[model samples]
Target chain A: MATAALTLYELAAADAALRFSPHCWKTRMALAHKGLEAERVPWRFTEKAAIAFSGQGMVPVLVHDGETVTDSWAIALHLEQRFPDRPSLFGGNGAMPLARFVNGWADTVLSPAIARIIVADVHGRVHAADRDYFRTSREQRFGQALEDVVADRPANLAAFRRALQPLRRALAGDAFIAGPAPAYADYCVFGMLMWARCISDVELLEPDDPVSAWRDRLLDAFGGLARSAPTARG
Target chain B: MATAALTLYELAAADAALRFSPHCWKTRMALAHKGLEAERVPWRFTEKAAIAFSGQGMVPVLVHDGETVTDSWAIALHLEQRFPDRPSLFGGNGAMPLARFVNGWADTVLSPAIARIIVADVHGRVHAADRDYFRTSREQRFGQALEDVVADRPANLAAFRRALQPLRRALAGDAFIAGPAPAYADYCVFGMLMWARCISDVELLEPDDPVSAWRDRLLDAFGGLARSAPTARG
Candidate 1:
């Protein structure tokens, strides 16, 4: 029995050192949780050609054992099955659906809310070649200039914080969202916060918020994997 | 060993047969999932004295033997810990926190959105002795009449449906939110729907929506426990 090489194409900022796509971060954390290290190939938004082999324009594309898996959620599921002897990504199969719900919440609600507050900052930090593409697509989707979308950031920040009440309440009596230890559910949310921290200056959460505390724990997990990641936030 | 006798005080409408409180419904579904039956006692909002022994004014108070439990979340936890051999409500201890997050989301996000759409209907259905108390307390909280709060129901309904994107996305790949089988997580969302159905004529979900399908399955679960329950929705 032989193990195959693993590689992950992750979204990167202008510096290339700044790898910060929320979806990609989820895959990164899941890999670390399984005690596996993959070569992270830095990818820019305009560099769709690099990931074409995966048949998708988006990344967090994982090439494992010469097999291609796209989408962060699918990659996470793949890792769990491939490394059953390692720490379980979902605690057990029964928890998978619940974790999926949390994954959906992060994708549909959490990340979208955070993106509105940091879209301008994200545009500013992208590679020069990707700036126009980023702005045009995002601006059209939002139906406004990125600058205008983020102009009322103070209000956006409040709304974002208010949206976090459920997470805060859940963490009040537990150490992590999945219970005693961090799991895929924690990764789903930390990935979003890491994305915000890596490419934006806006502090989406207050220092005292329980969610902020939970984020701190995740940052310190896996030998400070997320804490050591490149950041644009001061 | 003798098992403790269990009795649940559930919220009821003027008819006493129409039990509709979302929190109470959570407990009901949980008990049924565990295959445990408890005597259901009808309680009205103004009848706080009936539950005074629990040191709380809320319904869904569980009295087992000489022990008393208040709050739906607490009672669910108690039942799981006390009846370990019965069907697990959260799958396992590891899934508890994730279920708690779902519980919190149902309480803070789902129920509040539904409330704004059906509050006036709720006020109209409570026991006559409780109408003034329900209307006054809720009106004061909203800073407007209940009718005014729900007057623009078309807009409120749209917002409520939009808020369900995550739930809908989660159900796309699985039959239940907790995955292949129903669990506490399913109960959390179903309870809110039960509240709307029991007290309001308004349709909170489109008939073709996946969420509605999931709700229908829950209604038919546990030998039609929820299905047999009274509903005001035609």
Candidate 2:
């Protein structure tokens, strides 16, 4: 399958085994969904020199057979276009853009909501070299100390759940966001939850919530690929 | 085209030309996208008996030949399956469900936000006979008087605009939510905008907003079907 040539630089925590960045998980799940494997290189927040060639400071920089693809959405598109013979990440025509809306909701809405609940916890899990950098960068972006950002987690968690009504309604008639099977849209939202799942024990979704059930299905997909990620919960 | 037997029961305002219900507008645009015309029937809120045969008190009930289909999503699927040769509303395999997510967002998020700002204005536009029922029912549901619900519309308007970041982000890459062309997803969000357009003079979208541009494109689609709707600003 020529898997040896494919590489993905993924964000790692103090424990190299803990790869928890939501954006990177998106590429991870997309690779699994496409039945492709890549040598995952553990990257830390302070290690810009490792991915300097990509001209970006993101963890999900993909080096596919020497051609680099950065950004989760760009990586997914590269896989879909390069591996057309494989299963489709976008089920049909026009689905990609609409799925982008789901991606937008996850990025602009869901991820921020989840971050507000777990950003401080995430600061604790970063490697010693990356810890101060992560905290400062994130605190500056959020305009709050990392600890204060998550002070009202219980209330924030409730808002997070309410923010999922669109997803809940989307799933009211289908098993997945892309319908019938998990696709890029599912991965987009799942990646955010996977971020929460990989680092924290804060139960972002209730055990019985439809979204939780949906996340369970994805966690069990690709032979528990996401579920196997190290978490504070365990 | 054998379009003679289809009929769509749509909600009407006091003048009967002001068709503002968001759900009905979805079916309206879907039918236009299909290039199949229906004899539009003006059904007021109090005229439940007009569409009782569908076993639901909804204005978007579509009677095609001897069969009746209620609900916008159901009607869209029905139209797609029944008119396979028409312009495809979903575009591809998983698109129906992803489009449903857009539908869900429009229904649960966009419409509610629009209602918070313009619902009281809608009360004044309903048929005289339905005014009392509309005011009472909506007030009871909102737990506030008709006027009070939109008393803080200036603030609600800000939140409404903020809530549209996902849509704004989605449209950032494409001319429409469904990509380069208009489809059910575009119609779903457009329907909500049309609801605001049909009954309120308050501007929900800025002139340069991407969503406003997308709405303008749809208003120009199908020979200006949406643009022809009587708007309060007119």
Candidate 3:
């Protein structure tokens, strides 16, 4: 039986080629890790109807062989279970829960810290249809205008870097967060930084930082899949 | 040839039975998880000469068959390497690097946050000979007296609890950070909480928090090894 082609709805910028959502990047990297190819569908934030079939309003909505997976973490799990013979995403069963902790840290701590530094830039790069929705939702979340939220980018950037001490220390002895190789844990964090990289010009990491070196390695991973993506800065 | 008994130098309080150092608790839990018995030697902070042979000024210095291991992380790695046949501290090779991230998070983020709330309490519980040294070192670190460091206890306590959000989220779906069973990752964070529990009367975790429940499970782990420890509150 022929397998149906996997389709991924990714959060795209005004130029659909610029896919920058951190969560979607996680799925993108996971697919590349698993050696799976998917048909990329550029999605705007306000295009809820586009992914309504997934029973959720999220950009990382993956349609795999007629099965719909909404969350990025779930998509990675689906890919892992579906393609057990491929390179492992979590490395082992033990790492799945541990990766979840990394996922949680990225979601609650790292991404939020990056968001404060890049949300305003994000607003400028999003699709015209997504601009109002993104600005409105973010303004409500930050309780200020998008520009105002990033008005103190210097302090926000410092706090963001400080929040990365754990990641920095973790990478001090290893090439990647998952060990010597890039895996879901590294993807979980790299996706966030990718979000900033794709949408903003602000330098988030110093070149001398261990995290920057790790990010460079990841950018060169899977034949430079993430590096090839179009960035707003470009 | 008979194997020599393992000896662990653990940081002790005014009453030697009240072992309160967070790092020591990590080694303690790792030892129990590995099902290895070690003779606990009570070490006070002022007595740096006591562990001079190890070339370190810290407790949790594990002396195994004449091989001395300093630092909680090093001891854990030593135990894992020395007893590969036993229950794994890291569930698999993939988990070691991932667990290091957890260790780093506990060390840099969680422990420091907890110390702000409990430093004064910790100062009160150290051995009389160690009190002056402890207060002086901590004051120098905080740039203020111990009492003044924790003067904003309510705010510090709230911040500490907020810092546990990642842990709380991680434990929400699994019983332990290493998945269904407790491993080095769980021990790393649990050791920090145990530090607060043993030294401070300040209530760190709320009753209904998932983290509190996870802590309950660890307290009951290894036939209630941690729960059996004497807290300064009593």
Candidate 3 lDDT, A181-214, residue by residue in tens: 9899999999999999898888899889999999
lDDT of 3: 0.91
DockQ of each: 0.79, 0.86, 0.87
Model 1 chain A worst lDDT run, 10 consecutive residues: A1-10
lDDT for residue A148 in candidate 3, whole number 0-100: 83
What is the per-residue lDDT of model 2 for residues B1-234, given as tens digits with 9 covering 90 to 100? 665489999999998888898999999999999889899999999998877799989779899997999988999999999999988999976788899998999888887789999988898888899999999899888999978889998899988999999989988888888988889999998999899999999998778888788888999999999998888877
How much DockQ does model 1 earn? 0.79
Off by over 4 Å in 1: A1-4, B1-4
lDDT of 2: 0.90
TM-score of each: 0.96, 0.98, 0.97
lDDT of 3 by residue, B1-234 (tens): 345589999999998888998999999999999888899999999899999999979888999998999999989999999888889999888889999999999999998899899998888888999988989898999898888889998899899998998998898878988888999999999999999889888889889999888999999999999999999878
The global C-alpha lDDT for each of the candidates, from Candidate 1 onward, is 0.90, 0.90, 0.91
Candidate 3 regions with alpha-carbon error over 4 angstroms:
A1-4, B1-4
By descending lDDT, how would the candidates be arranged?
3, 1, 2
The DockQ leader among the candidates is 3
For residues A1-234, could you state the per-residue lDDT of candidate 2 as single tens digits? Answer: 444379999999898888899999999999999999899999998999999999988879999889989999999999999888789999865789987989999999998999999998888888999888988889899999988889998899998999999999988888898888999999999999989888887888888899989998999999999888788777
TM-score of chain B, candidate 3? 0.97
Error of 1 at B18 (Å): 0.9
